[model samples]
Target chain A: MSRPSDVYLFGTCLVDLFMPDAGMDAITLLETLGIRVHFPQAQSCCGQPAYTSGHPREARDVARSQLDLFPGDWPIVVPSGSCGGMLKHHWPTLFAGEPEQERVVAIAARVVEFSDFLLNHLDWQPVDTGPATRVAVHTSCSARREMNVHTTSWALVDRLANVTRVVHDHESECCGFGGTFSIKHPDIAGAMVTDKARALEDSGAIEFVTADAGCLMNINGKLALDKATPLRGKHLASFLLERTGGKS
Target chain B: MNSQPVTLYPSRQFKDNARAALADTELRGSLRSAMDFLMAKRSSAFPDTDELDALRTLGEAIRQRCLSRLPELLEQLEERLTANGVTVHWAETPAQANAIIHGLVAARNGTLMVKGKSMVSEEIELNHHLEAHGIQALESDMGEYIVQMAGEKPTHIIMPAIHKTKAQIARLFHEKLPDTPYTEDVDALIRIGRNALREAYLQADVGLSGVNFAVAETGTLCLVENEGNGRMCTTVPDLHIAITGIEKVVEKLEDVVPLYSLLTRSAIGQPITTYFNMISGPRRPGEKDGPREVHLVLLDNGRSQAYADQQLRKTLQCIRCGACMNHCPVYSRIGGHAYGTTYPGPIGEIISPHLLGLENTRDLPTASSLCGACGEVCPVRIPIPEMLMRLREESQRPAGEAVDHPLRGQGAAASTTEALAWRAWRRVYASPGTYRLFGWSATRLRALTPPTQAGWTQNHVPMTPAPKTLHELVREREARRKES
Candidate 1:
């Protein structure tokens, strides 16, 4: 069974509403590799917010609307590891023993995060250009455990010429965004992100990148709030595109 | 430890305790360093991932098999224990267990009881009960002795005094111990505690210990510990009473091998604990130095409540390794004191609800970030994050409504405003047209969105919606492509 040449992009709710540039960069990257990308018109949210917030019934209703968006078995690529993990790992279990269980299983198989799709499925590689810079990589919990996209992101970043991959303390620890968790338990979330910010600063990296939109938004928000913070956060899609001389 | 059931519902104060703990910089530093060290040790212990993963699978399977046939196994355990001349007693609640133990002690006219570190005893509050009835039970474990002397509870299960520093322990010893000078050395502090406990062991009329594993086939109660105090407490005294939750029983002695290996490795990162004491029965004719009478008290508490439900039955599979707590981000930050339960951290969050009901422990399940670190490090492979989600759902249900879950009417339901808002959100996202309208409005009204979003704005910049939705940008791109 050969990999699919074309795929559909699940523009996550966070991407659609919060950062459309990332979603567009993902599409541009796929098309640059000569693979046709389909953006379904009806897709909205992956229901992760409701699902994780303890409203499983609502989560199912919202998730059910997306169960048939890409019906022809073309792979469904998600740019954010948080959303990709939800679709690939959690959706099947959420609908277990239900009417849509079979469809959920089939959909789960085709779902892959952007970096994972690029490196493993499409064999995408970036050409090195000599511009020395130290950059730190922040792998979201979902990216690290659920999809194993951290290794792919690391490989992608390491391949870029003259870019030193600096290691920091506790890189794999959560930034504590956790979607609603930041809002619900802001103190703990704030403390967690503060520690993450310090680690990034201590690494002396000019910029940090993450594949998940949730952590990017969280760490970036924290960095933006602190005027003295010397670090910047970017989505892995935008970072990869900039490094490879592709349009953002 | 109180003799009667301590209020398990004190988890309601979790928020307040967590706030106080967060403010304590010293506690935060200790917890951070301790958790980091323990996590690194555990990872280093299992250098071979394949072997560790396979062992975890076997450990999980053993627990599942035991729980699936729990009733049959319990009967088998009783029969085997009786045949071995070990008296097995059953208690359904904390009060009953306390009464049964107290009766056993009173019958023997026992004045002093020496205890090994037992979380179950803490759960039943046996020491306080014994104290009230004129029987003194002294904690023989160094950490447990310090906690007991300081008039505090065991904060961490394995490392009860983990929250204390060497200097603080030295101070505690000088203040509490008889004729003890202040010495800020680790070995000196251990010597102080050892000297105090050695006399108690000899003078203790009865010995109390907790079981790490109860083998049904062989009727052997296995105790895992680094110190030999557990052995002293169980063997040196004339009478010995070992108590454990009903869920600790396994089908055969062989099943304990993988579990013991994982427990030791995951617990303190040792290939094996210093002592693995397995006591099948009291002394027979020629046995030189064993207890004359051995008593086994099987306490249920709320274990059957957890066992009756299929999804929650996984809570019973825990081997009390403490790896989950060590790796838990929330626990590391807040420490165990904030949890205010007999068992604290990830395992406590899932199991406390069953013992104390959901209404009291509602905050505990919601306390985690759902980071899944606990699940990854768990030796028995307990799906902690999944259970937290399930408990969250249980918390949002209305009281007395018809639900099939075992924890249905047991929750402190969410406020009406929260429930209504969630329902409205479901309505909006269920339809594509409605979602598009909401998204468009959100983008247009981005400027009006509050700069201060529920305390998040205090540390983070305000959340600003993008100027245009992806759908709108895609449509514009399509129009340009068509023109080209």
Candidate 2:
């Protein structure tokens, strides 16, 4: 099937700095399927921080910047479900009573969680992997509710050869890194993530896995913070590529 | 006991706790059985009626209206209650609430007060104040009495003993009821509870209960419940004390209908609770029962602060059905004890900080998955997750070290990791052209992303980015439609 044109990638902040490879990998995946991808130079955070925290003004600033940066209907795909969820669910809220409601409505129609996009539009099939390894999977609230991407991710992972996957026992729990939530409620955040790390250890998989890096970092940090007994955190993309001997 | 709060982890914490808690053979078996039973029963009671949704909408509207005129309604209630042979008192805080109750019982030359299930009583720790006065207040609701007898707070709002096993209850029964035979059967257990509380209800002169909805129209007080104790509390005593938060007042009886309807369905999945009692004035001359004088105590205690903020006023719409808590992932794991307060679950977390001061209850907000399930399951449809997140924000924005937040750095809005992540994200994908170019690059490197986004790829296969932009496809489709 011929790929649709002008695929735009809105790499969320967590993916851009902490893990750029996911961004690059996403681009490669699109191009291989014959779709040309574009990156918005001025793309910034989705202003979820200010929005979730009740700071409508700051969120408006960030959201307006995002709207301006990606003006005109391009199906904006974001790597992190956390960011994508914010754009789709919260940005519209920012415009509830304001003049920008029209802008919010237009953009709201264009945002999609990357996984759901691939599964729905691309009819994604798990690529042939050379080898399979044991892995565990975690689903975040963002993708769980906004996209239902968890099922899609699991289905794709199940297709890999030589892979034994352990799904996150608490597939819907939060990592407690709710934008500014972690730093503000550090102890609670710490306690919550410690619990998550323990779940990963209990998953019986060698590696703890999830779709969002923010959740991964929070869980991994908690594992380190408490010196949790077992299981280590890894991203979904990294685990898939490991079997194929692609990036890692 | 540990001084530090028990934590499962940060973003992933609730997930782990919920999983572990759900995996517990005993806990899950009981929880699944109970939750399903309650949900099924509730649905059966409502029977897919459009009236239920209409009631919920009306309930939401009534609550919103009540919240808007809270101060006026409260004044009206106070005036009406006092005129109806009842003493009306107002408490600005929990401490004040406790002290008022202590003074009232002390003045009556009483040592014991019988209480029905009032979460407000728990908030104010009225029992302790009474105990200090050498008075012993007894809990009368079967579930509440059971929880009290076990020396623990209620876990679930409606079914306080949901976390307990039959064996635990049998043991508790054995210990608490030395004279009665301890049994494991549910009906037998209820009989024991009924037998034990009957004595307390008959003996106590001053009965205390929570007002579910206080009507200002005719100086009326309403208590909704399945148990008979709520009825007996306001009816059986010579003097009755009703402690209510100000937000519970409704301007008219019609407004209360919708609010009360949602309360039952959301709680225990019931169409309507077995009993909804409306009490007007005290017993008149020649009256065979009820208190000679009724007392309504309106407690402010952080409710006004919540009302001051428009975004949060929606929380007042809650009917205390416990649906939000029942469906909550966080409450499922930690139960209510982890909250360390009278209120538990999502609603508790949101209101506790305001009631108990953020310093003592700051941890409550962090204990959520932000799953939005609570909002969905709510009868009044309170946006609990959204409110909880807002509390997290309120706690963080102040930049206090060990003031409102327990930890020195806890609740700070800015973090190096989060800030750094934001900085890098802003550098690209801000424009359509760059976004497309970047998408192409990601697709090309799909084979190599594991090493790139290692943490994310751990559990699931990262789906390759879509081959076609939905926008592009949509545009083409639309253009073709236009041509046709």
Tell the DockQ for candidate 1: 0.71
What candidate 2 gets wrong by more than 4 Å, as runs, is: A1-4, A17-35, A42-44, A47-67, A92-106, A115-139, A146-248, B1-55, B79-85, B103-107, B399-484
Query: Per-residue lDDT of B240-349 in model 2, one digit per residue for the tens?
Result: 88998888898998877777767777786665778888888789899788788777888877776677777777777777888777766556545665566677788887
In model 2, what is the error at residue A183, expressed in angstroms? 7.8
Q: Write the per-residue lDDT of candidate 2 for residues A1-248, one digit (tens) a residue.
A: 22357678887756654565666667666656666777765564677765665455556766776777665466887877878888887778777888888888888778877666666777766665655467777777778766657686676567777778776545556666665556544444444565566667777777756768678766765565455455666666555555545554
Off by over 4 Å in 1: A1-3, B1-9
C-alpha lDDT score of every prediction, in listed order: 0.87, 0.69
TM-score of chain A of each: 0.96, 0.88
TM-score of chain B of 1: 0.96
For every candidate, what share of the true interface contacts is present? Answer: 0.57, 0.11
DockQ-based CAPRI category assigned to the predicted complex of candidate 1: medium
Which residue window of length 10 is worst by lDDT in model 2 chain B?
A: B1-10
DockQ of each: 0.71, 0.10
